[model samples]
Target: MTSPLHTTRRAFTWMLGTALVGGASACGLSGTGGRGVIFRMGLRTAKAPGEESPGEFTTDTGWRIRLSSGVMVLGPIYIFENASPLEPTASAPRVLQRLGQWLLPTAHAHDGHFFSGGTVLGEWDREVVFDLLEEAGEVRELGRSPGIAGLARSFSLLLQPPSRALGAEGAALGGRSMILEGTASRQETHVPFRMALDFPPPVELQRVDFVPIAAELDEGGRFVVEVQPHRWFDGAHFDRVTVPEGGGVVDLTPDTQVYRALTLNVRRYTAFAGTWEPA
Candidate 1:
């Protein structure tokens, strides 16, 4: 049987070709006349809508989670001039294009492979440690960078392990990319859990590529990244977590279903969103 990973990769490869052909008219190869602009960027964490408090939310499985602490290392943000080709807007043309790909003999040879061919509109290549429990409305400035003016359509970033240069913040994370301490309760079962994760598993899975966005970047602007940590546990099941014999905190590892679900969700593009505002 084909592994799920291989299946997903193969599907993505086909979608990639479809997107390239479908999005060509929208993302032309024409140059922007070398026009440049400087933009301010910021990042912040927010609770999913309807949550009563920061670091606190109830999962779909009836588990109520209250996190006492949360931290993450994220950076090297990139803005692309091309929108995600996989978007469902242009159905007829995409279907025709996909049919054409099906007839090509080289198509199967490119299965399970991927690449980005979009033009870079902006970037912030530095890593920053974020306190996921920070006030919801607070914005952490990421300095400024020069970029080409264009229609910003997609975003990408890397989730990095804490670096020593981050000083106390780095030390707090204990060399992990993310750390969360919290309590979860469902019905009569209550458990305290600590999850320290280098999410994406293989380390290189740190790169989150091509999240679709629609923003016009011109002259000068501000780019903002909002992270919703609560969504990271959307599919987690606290009831399945084994409680300690003496009532101690449970350390979540790869072996647990919660840990596995978190690893998959944290890398999901839905957990993060980016927008651009004109200055």
Candidate 2:
């Protein structure tokens, strides 16, 4: 089978910048003795011009919205060491399977962790489930694996709902993958809205890629997989939705107008703008 495609990126920046860490030939597939690499990752909101942070913004529809609780389950971040293999005959890099994979496959998201693949040097496990909104504003730790060897040409991220694998015991997230509880207001009308996004494994498989741009991971480099929250509501139409009387709560269940908008919103926003690393 053909290997995953590779992309080239000259430079990436927003409020943050993706710098060129570990030089081109810094390190590749090291053995027992060598300067190991620290793999860091996190989720951050896009920096709005006037705003200091990403959340707490208004939509184009004139409806003011804010995230009351933005709890989410994300995981299985695979960093492809040699994504673009020079040759097919080259032996696959070794995978140092960690013990129990961050608590084991049976672990929960609360105290347990669902670690995916192990490291290349047959050392520690590299993947884990993270509460993206749990530790907002701060760069939460992702696990560390020695030997930041080779070029991390590309990486794939798998974000799912609260599961035994995700280590989050469905935070009141009954029958849904993503639970978005917030309030929307228009003029003098303030309505509470609860949007439950159903992520049936298949939809949870979206990837953030910078193709045609050679985005490589460097040693001692810190990378964050940021998700722009506001981007999720891009091109969404709220004026067309019909809110229930009295309650004024817009329940965005599946198949509803607002529901469809939420679905498309995620699809459009769930992508990497580019790689950026602050000095």
Candidate 3:
């Protein structure tokens, strides 16, 4: 049997869901891998109606996101914002579904070890997906997994100005920012996109520090920018990142193995412009 502490860590890691993968690296730049550069990222939560509380026995729809190793650096960005009529099975009040969106920018890597060579984020369209085991005794199962523990260590919010990573100034003062843009879990091409942030880069391991900013959903179930934070994906990849000198182009061909495990359908896109501010 897994230790209670370990199980809890895993659960907490996935609670952030897809945000955990990309949370370690932002600005479309990979980390130094060897800890030479402290990868700091800050992220805000994109809240919606169903996210707060699942209304009386409804299908609580949410998202569970996982990424490939390479995608971790390039980021597909996971999001679970936006809820439906799905009902939660757990007695835990947190059993309600959550709604939000996320974004990811093309990232550059110098050494393959940085944020390169793996899935960055994975997303599930429903929060129930993570409700794997419902025994109340297993509630702590979420705090175990080293991966989850690693994700928690990657976020923070202790600074003079609350280090919300809601603005460039705060991020600059703190180090880096990782704003969530939106999430896509279904096969349809019409999903709404919400945004948030992750700061500092290479989050300190096993530390719990993340502040969530709520976003309002539009009449059409789409998200409208309510609390605009710092920058989404770091100013649309505005900052110049350094790749290895003469490093060959990164082969981003999607691996079927990683795809199936993460359960995400890949797509090529070209629209990143939007009506929001860089916090």
TM-scores of all predicted structures: 0.75, 0.59, 0.17
Candidate 2 at residue 72, lDDT? Answer: 53
lDDT of 3 by residue, 1-279 (tens): 643233333343343443435543441354322111122122222222343311111111222221111101112122222221122325535423322112222222224322222322222211111111122112211111112111110111111112332344344323322222222232332222222222222222122121122222111121111111111121221112222355432221123222221112111111111111112
TM-score (C-alpha, index-matched) for candidate 3: 0.17
Candidate 2 local lDDT, 133-201, one digit each (tens): 456556665545333444444444444455554334554556455667677667876767778776454
lDDT of each prediction vs. the true structure? 0.70, 0.44, 0.22
Position 130, candidate 1: lDDT: 84
Global local distance difference test of model 2? 0.44
lDDT of 1 at 222: 85
Ranking by lDDT: 1, 2, 3
C-alpha positional error of residue 228 in candidate 3 after TM-score superposition, expressed in Å: 12
Provide the clashing-pair count of each candidate structure.
Answer: 0, 20, 90
Evaluate residue 266 in candidate 3 and report its C-alpha lDDT on the 0 to 100 scale.
Answer: 15
- Highest-scoring model, lDDT: 1
Residue-level lDDT tens digits of model 1 in 1-279 = 644344332243344435434344444446552356788888877766787676788887878888998889887677766665433355558777545433422112222223343656667766788887776547777788766667778776778677677899688877898888999998888889999988433333675665678877666678888887777897798778888788999999989999988877776665678877788
Q: Arrange candidates by TM-score, highest first: which order?
A: 1, 2, 3
